[model samples]
Structures are given as C-alpha cells and as structure tokens.
Target: MQLALPGFEDYDRVCEGLQEKATKELIASYTDGREMNPSAVFICKTMINLSRNFDILNAKGRDTSRVMAQLLSWFQELEDKLPRASELKPEVAALLGEAKA
Candidate 1:
C-alpha cells in the first residue's frame, strides 16, 4: 500500500537525512508561532488542500488515490506535529480563506 513514486521516495529520503535543527528551521519558514502545529503546519494545510482537490487532480490524469494515500501517510507520520480540529468544516473553511491571500 506504499503509494510513493520513485521521485517521492528520493525526496523523502533527502528530508530524512537532514539534521533535526535544519528540519525544524525548514518547517519554521512556513509558519509562525500562532499555528497549532507550528513545526509542521504546512503538511496539515497540504493534506486539506489535496483532499479538497482530488477531483481536479483526477481530471488532470493524476492518480488521485495514490496522491491521497501519500498525503495520508505524511499526515500520519507528522500527526504529533499536525493540527487538530474539533469541527473540520470550519477548519477547512479557514484553510480555504487563507489560500485567497
């Protein structure tokens, strides 16, 4: 059930090779302290966006399921550093709103 393509595997390997501080620095570049998952909020945001656009991706001949599986794996891997939501609809709306800016 591993859906990663070759290039993605390479990318993940490279990310894994980074030092802890470097990884934290990289994640910090995409977020400020206000975020729930300041260390990996981008992954959470990406998961939301990807799930929202699965139809568009499928229309474009992309493997939507495979991509979704990958996103799910990443989400799980970073679960501890990812945000939580009591009400997902509002969270998704907020995410969409942020995208407009």
Candidate 2:
C-alpha cells in the first residue's frame, strides 16, 4: 500500500483505473456514489494494501522488523524519485519520518 501510494500521483485516478479490473470488484463495490478526494482515496488504498500485505507476510512467517524495513526501503526509493516525479507533490518529501525534523 505504501508502495502504491508513492507510485501513484492521483489516487482517484488510480481508483478509476482499478474499476476496469475484475480483481478490484471488492473495492469498486464500495466506491460507488462516494465523494472521495485524492488524499482520502490514497489513504484508504494504502490502509487496505497494508492490511492485506501484512496478512500475507504474517502467514508466510516473516518478522515484523523485516516488514518495516521493506516498507521503509520503499519509501526511501519514493523519496529518491520525487524530485523527478511527473505528478506527485514536491512537498511529499516532508511527509517522510526521516524528513520530519
């Protein structure tokens, strides 16, 4: 989910993209008539993915620290790409934990 958030520029657009896929039927089922802006949509997608992926990892017996490390590495790569990103906010760098201070 964290990976997907940083990879996508427009959350709503990403949701719309998912609408065409049968795999996303569960998600699309709830989005109907909802007024989800980009950020909210992004957060929702992120949370869903996080829960789903963590479940998979937990089932596979992966450790918590390993999961955190993987997520952090993904965020770091996203930070590296932001300066050159075509659609993501330049200010997104400020959202990172390491950049907060």
Candidate 3:
C-alpha cells in the first residue's frame, strides 16, 4: 500500500536536505572546537523518534504505512523545532525493540 500526505511530494528531498545540513553543521562545530548545536541534535532526535514510533506502530498490528507517512509529514512540518524530553520516554524506546515479526 502507498500512503502519502498531500503537498509533501517533496518530503524526501526536504529530509535529505535537512540531513545534509545537519551533518555539515555538526562537522563544522566539532572542527571549530565547539559543541554540536541544539538544532543538529534536534534533527537527529526527531528522526530517531519517528523511526521508533514507526516501529512501535507496526508491531502493534496497526496500519503503520499510513501512520508512518503522516508522522513523516509532521516531522517535515516541525523540522526546525526541538522535541521535549517527555516525548522521548524509555517506554517508547522499549516498544521500538519489541518483536514485530
């Protein structure tokens, strides 16, 4: 099944761009003897959270394809924002590691 969000036809491109920018920024920060910026960390965390949620949704016998597409769309919308600590609970991580096969 194919699931997509309207007006997000360029979502893959946007995600790739964000990843590239974050990687460059992180490298520059490290080279300059500075800590990685919050924005870069936020991008990585956002991706990780999305991945974990997708895994959980799939393992729960849910329609993960549609939900994953929507989650990616939401992430695309909030690419510039940082996630709260409460959003990344240990329970969520455990769910991601559960059996889905």
Candidate 4:
C-alpha cells in the first residue's frame, strides 16, 4: 500500500510566517546528511514545533501537562520504530538519543 504524504497547506495554515520558516529550517537540519524518511522528517518537525510551544506554555505558567504527554508519546513512538543500537549508525543513534527516543 502507498502512504499519502501530508500536504504543506496544513502546516502553512497552522504555522504563520516566521514559525513556518523556522519549521522548514528545522526539518532541513534534521534531514541534512542523513538518510531519513520524508515522513520521519515531517514528524520531527511537528514534534519540534510542539516542544517549542510546550516550553512557551510552561514558561508562561500555563498548564502544559497535556502537551508534555503528547511530546513524550511522539518520542516513544518514533523510538519504537528505530533499529537496535548495534544495527544503527552511531550518528543516527546519537540523534535518536538527543530526541529522547
């Protein structure tokens, strides 16, 4: 079965101007020099955005327990998809660790 790629329109609609640019830049940074699936890149970008928002909410004394749970769930899901450490490239493994996966 074929997987449907997400459209940029959704991202654009949700993230305005500078935020959109930042998200794209972050996605590029994560994908650069790495053999990553486009879907994974998209997921990472979303997680990064969510994380930033979570930080902001926490700093502002807003309730962010829900967002925190979501962020952790995403990390866990991504980590579950990763190959065993011994089978993965050191750099890739390191990146996974940085993601808290």
Which candidate's TM-score is highest? 4
Candidate 2 structure quality by residue, lDDT tens digits, 3-91: 45575656644433221242245445545445556654664455455445555666667865654455445444433433232334656
In the range 17-96, model 4's lDDT, one tens digit per residue, is 34335545655654465556666656676677777777667667899888768866765655555435666889988897
CA lDDT, every model vs. true structure: 0.54, 0.47, 0.52, 0.63
Higher-scoring candidate on TM-score, 2 or 3: 3
Q: How far is candidate 4 from the true structure (C-alpha RMSD, Å)?
A: 9.7
Can you tell me which runs of candidate 4 are displaced by over 4 Å?
1-34, 85-101
In the order shown, the candidates' Cα RMSDs to the true structure are 14.0, 15.0, 17.0, 9.7
Best candidate according to lDDT: 4
Segments in model 3 whose C-alpha atoms lie over 4 Å from true places: 1-36, 70-101
Task: Give model 2's TM-score versus the native structure.
Answer: 0.31
Q: What is the TM-score of each candidate against the true structure?
A: 0.35, 0.31, 0.32, 0.48
Instruction: For candidate 1, give the lDDT of residue 42.
Output: 63
Per-residue error (Å), model 3, residue 88? 33
lDDT of 4 at 5: 60
Instruction: After the best TM-score superposition of candidate 4, give how far the Cα of residue 64 lies from its true spot, in angstroms.
Output: 1.2
Clashing pairs in 1: none
Q: List residue ranges in candidate 1 displaced over 4 A.
A: 1-35, 59-62, 82-101
Screening candidate 2 with a backbone cut-off below 3 angstroms (N, C-alpha, C), the clashing residue pairs are none
In candidate 2, position 5 carries an lDDT of 54
